[model samples]
Target: MANIMLTKDQWDALQRHLLPNPFKVEEAAFLFVKVTESGDFECVDSWCMQPHDFDYQSAFHISLRDETKAAVIKRAHDTGTALVEAHSHLGKWPAEFSRSDLCGFDSFVPHVRWRLKGKPYAAIVLTTADYDGFAWIGDATDPVRIDGLVIGDVDRLGPTGLTPLTWGPWEDFDGHI
Candidate 1:
């Protein structure tokens, strides 16, 4: 797996869309970014998941309409881009990937890959400050963790070769920015 690059604007937009109601119950969002996978993964543009894509979803889980899923797969196949399925984890900074998440992807991710003619499929879970994500580069049930998310010059590293990063004690409010 390789690092995923997001332009600052794209990154901020995603964060805003996903984190708006963080104080409340969990909400999920999706992004289908234009990806280039030469040496690494690069997302140059993105499409945010819309309101209609979700139905009576919950704070703990998200489900896409079958049509929405089919459309995204078709688009990815026609346009030739990787698909990223992202949602939020409302309660923690360094959120853990729930067993529920795994069960959901065991089938969903592979189907998306098949539809896209083997284009990469990724599942990402974000928190207020960080995220955990993995990618299925091949047709395996397991995934290789993403390497990192590059924002400008810094690397928000992920669990690629090593274990996921742990958050240290934090201050609820940052007086000094």
Candidate 2:
């Protein structure tokens, strides 16, 4: 089980971007992380996607513009950092990936891995109260659940009941960003 470690200030800044007030719609961001020798992801910095970064957005979904995707990928490539995609969910839904999300990952994850020459990729879904995430480690075909989060000195475990799983080859998935 792997974990992500964030400094107090980094966690606070990320929370602010993901759960901004007047939060009528979902938001997305990318956390640039360094893969430590111990196999944990250490947060380096974050890029909060702005409104113009998305080609489509609603309270339930979002699609990033191609240019926005390109820019993030470029930055990650140049900096030799792994990317953890983070997004918000309105209301109080459990922070699990939706079916649409899995479908999207089938395509996007492979593409990103190819582009980045196989750097690990991860995604996290967040609501006001909870978060769940998974990561592709090494060259594994399936992802392992991200087991915990280290915020400053406090180590918080992820929600119970999440198991490692493979995302799919589903056809016709209209996904959120």
Candidate 3:
């Protein structure tokens, strides 16, 4: 399992973008991250999707415009960084990926790996109070849990506090395999 580390300021900025006031619907973003020597992802920058970036959006779903997707890919290509796709889930739902989200990943992840020359790709789903993440590393077919998050010097996702709900093979939900 790998972790993602970001400065306090970066975390703050990302939260603001993700959980804005009047947040009536889900929002999405692409985080451009560099793999650190210690095998963690360091967020270098992010592109928060705007209204015009999406072809459709509601409280439960969002579809990025083709141009928006292309732009995010291009940015990762230009920056030579791995990509982490992120989005929000409204209300009190757990921060877990939906079946629809997994279906989307089936196509998108392979395309991204090909375009980015086999660089890893990841996704994180955030609710108001928690998050869960997964990563497809190298040629692996299944994803590993993104087990922790380090905000500045604090371990926000460690076992003792704010731990994400377990998903994938470790647990099952809604008949998800």
Q: In the order shown, what is each candidate's alpha-carbon RMSD?
A: 8.8, 2.0, 4.5
The most accurate candidate by lDDT is 2
Quality of model 2 by C-alpha lDDT: 0.83
Model 1 segments more than 4 A misplaced: 22-25, 33-39, 159-177
Instruction: Give model 3's clash tally.
Output: 0
The TM-score-based order of candidates, best leading, equals 2, 3, 1
Residue 66 accuracy (lDDT) in model 3: 87
Of candidates 3 and 1, the better by TM-score? 3
> Candidate 1: RMSD over Cα atoms?
8.8
Ranking, lDDT, top scorer first: 2, 3, 1
In candidate 3, stretches whose alpha carbon ends up further than 4 angstroms from where it belongs are 158-177
lDDT of each: 0.66, 0.83, 0.80
Q: Which of candidates 2 and 3 is the stronger one according to lDDT? A: 2
| Evaluation by TM-score, superior candidate among 1 and 2 | 2
lDDT preference between candidates 1 and 2, better one: 2
lDDT of 2 by residue, 57-132 (tens): 7788888899999999999999999998998888876677777677767778888888899988888888888888
Tell me the spans in candidate 2 whose CA falls farther than 4 Å from its real position. 160-164, 167-169, 172-177
How far is 162's C-alpha from truth in model 1 (Å)?
11
Residue-level lDDT of model 1, residues 1-177, one tens digit each, is 756777788778878887785345455655555556353566655566666876545667666778877877777676677777777767754755665566567668777777777777776777886777787776555677887777767656563232232222334522211
